[model samples]
Target: MVTTKLEIHGRVGVIFHAILEHRHYSADQPPESLFQFIDYSNKCLETVKRSVEEYCAAKERQGFFIEQDNLSMFYETLCVGYDWNENLEDHSPTAFAESSQPPLPLPLIQQQQPQPEESEGGKPPKINLSQQRERAAKLKYKDLADYFDYPIQEAARLLNLCPTVLKKICRQEGVPRWPHRKVKSLKKQMDKVKDFMSSNVCTVEESASLQESLNKLQRDLDITVAGGKIAE
Candidate 1:
């Protein structure tokens, strides 16, 4: 059977002690040698498995859990180290590998920006965001409330989305298993805002502020109705 989760505090302790030993006994070695040693040790750990009782025992002793994302980042750093090692033709590959220079700093993660097509001439194409928002806002909170009266699958079908996606939206909105009552409550709140905006009791600045608040509430309600987090 495959291990869904693993606790490796003992393994980590061993590695930490080994690193300390290396630093003490082989003080002249470069940082790259230590990185290579850790990578080799991790590869060895990949083949081992522990029973449920053993895993629990390890957790009780000193638990360490590596999330999937962190593990991926760790592998990325290892790849960089391996590439650095491959580039050093003259350097000896050993536990006591010698180098006078310091190890290169790990590369920073850069977000990938959207690239323009060949026709765009380095400029991103114009997107009619207002029109998109208008379409999303078309499904009023009351209508959404009404839609939820049906089964989840049926309501999702009416909204032109799968049930799973609709449920995800509800979860994002922090509503119950379904958001019928939530939508109805938002609808009532919006109605109150509109009614207050129409009354002759506010100044221009206050009216503008009220309008902004209404727009924000509309967007929040529409996010649930739209069944996805549509970026502005």
Candidate 2:
């Protein structure tokens, strides 16, 4: 009988390790019960979440904070495998093989790419105002919050919005609120700043300055928007 195993393996911190094991029946087993796989996957995720939360809380109580980048790396490496027909297009055998390979490491390189313009005369292209507003309205606050590691309240405040209104906007945009708490660390903070800058709303120098400012603000503000002070 072919055996399918799902394993979660990673180092939580300098001295901590995390491993979760799960097994599912092979294709020869009753495939009609595949819905069990979904339940199994959910259980696996919940287990990982509980483990990581406990680990983080314990470390924090010990005055050793787990770096956000480390936490992100750990989650990224947690393998979630599903037992399915190898011949299925969505489950192509080659895809499984590729997923097992270690991701390539590369240095960060930024090259300026030219932006498309209306014409050589350099007149800025005209955009439909109504369409632009419609698109902007579609921007999901929850997804943005997740991307920036902020709570819905914090995200809404930063965007000069009402939490309920922003949440509705997110739902309209088909974006789900991130279920996990914001991971905290210098690396995560810098990453958030970089994302904001890359939105082309700010310059590199501005981004760097904002990153530094935000770090300082987080320390003072406790990374939450409270008492009318937006965390951003």
Candidate 3:
């Protein structure tokens, strides 16, 4: 078996790490799902390789070295090292493999001067980001408040926030200390969805339908975010 050697450095290393963090999905991701991920990961690594080569050439410093392989090897290492057993969830690969180098001075970015009073490159998105976040937050607040119950103590354990912080939020938001009336119904609905997602229906039509629904729902939720500034 043969493998390639690629030397990445500084910003390029950072870029590769970012791509790694974002690309891999769940442990249950099927073999068929890997083609696209591998393609994207390779493209990103290639771009970073080129960019780092040029940058390091200009800077005259020895860059970082990385072994180029199927990426699954690296990902497997990360999964075992990072404790991604059950849930097989998406987590940043960077958390397991941090940058080896200390922070260096960034290169100065040189940009072409634009004509005075020229319009910005593109029109902004009409949606409001803050509004979108508020919308999402409202859903989360309800989930934390009702599903987990008030003071949000036990529920806070499920999230990154401290119990005290969540309690503060509950108080500040004037959220009641009792579960919402919809909790039982919501739980049933969510359970059904989870079961469906975990099932292997094996029919092409069913798979296509599920994919279509998921895509449409994701688009809807993306558009629902409240922000004037659009995604870049």
Candidate 4:
């Protein structure tokens, strides 16, 4: 499940408070326990940073990009308690040790062999529309939303459908209007349910459970579509 920014903020606050509460240190050197807490805090921050960067990249691929400067400013503001600044130089022994390490050798085996010929005129290869739509047909709207970041145009291109058709699918699938007050709530719920149902099914029992979940989702879609038809 995707965690909200406020939830992340609260987690960081708890971690900071715990560190301060248990802190025991000296002017010349910090206690070993302090190092452990600091390491844990760094891990939490690093995880959040990686997730944000990945999310930003995915959004950019779908024609949306967030400002990096704002993220930088937010990070720096959080570091104020540690007296961090852009002008500060790293003089720590750990930094020196890391910098002294030699680079590792390159991989001996190439995973991807080079294509024999480039596309003519330097243009990208065209997508096989039939194959693309076939693959899309196997995917649920929830799956398509996650893969394409919920942009109607991107999903439409893959599914070989117009924006209006995709919107109709969304309605049949019971996904609320994208412009509603809880804009992300619908997407987040879809992502959570679909991912959970698809993952970690090994035994027959688990497989049956997954099947039941899929059937339920299909039933909901059918009912919505039938109701709409009757209303018309």
User: What is the clash count for each candidate, in the order shown?
Assistant: 0, 0, 10, 0
Candidate 2, residues 1-232: lDDT per residue as tens digits? 1112122322321111222211222222321111111122224545656755664565456544233322334224222232122212332322222223332211111112224454457774443434643455566443354434556545544543434344454444443433224334544665676678678789778878887877775654343212123444
What TM-score would candidate 3 get against the native? 0.19
Off by over 4 Å in 2: 1-138, 141-147, 173-232
Worst 10 residues of 1 by lDDT: 17-26
Candidate with more favorable, higher TM-score: 2 or 4: 4
Worst 10 residues of 4 by lDDT: 103-112
The TM-scores, one per candidate, come to 0.29, 0.19, 0.19, 0.23
- Looking at model 3, the pairs that clash are 127-227, 127-228, 128-226, 128-227, 128-228, 129-226, 129-227, 131-226, 132-225, 132-226
Q: Candidate 4 residues 105-141, lDDT tens each?
A: 1111111122333456775444443465456445555
Candidate 1 shows a clash count of 0
**Candidate 2 vs. true structure, TM-score:** 0.19
The lDDT leader among the candidates is 1
lDDT of candidate 1 over 76-194, digit per residue (tens):
33233232333233332444342333232222111112334333376544434335434443544334555765666567545544343444445445544676655667777889989
The candidate with the higher lDDT, 3 or 4, is 4
- Badly placed stretches (over 4 Å) of model 4 are 1-123, 147-150, 154-161, 176-181, 184-232
Model 2, total clashes: 0
After best superposition, candidate 2 residue 90: deviation in angstroms? 43
Q: 3 or 4: which has the higher TM-score? A: 4
Residues 116-157 of candidate 3 have per-residue lDDT tens digits of 432265543232323543444444333453334323434443
Name the runs in model 3 displaced over 4 angstroms. Answer: 1-168, 171-191, 197-202, 212-232
Local distance difference test values of all predictions, in order:
0.43, 0.38, 0.35, 0.37
lDDT of 2 at 165: 48
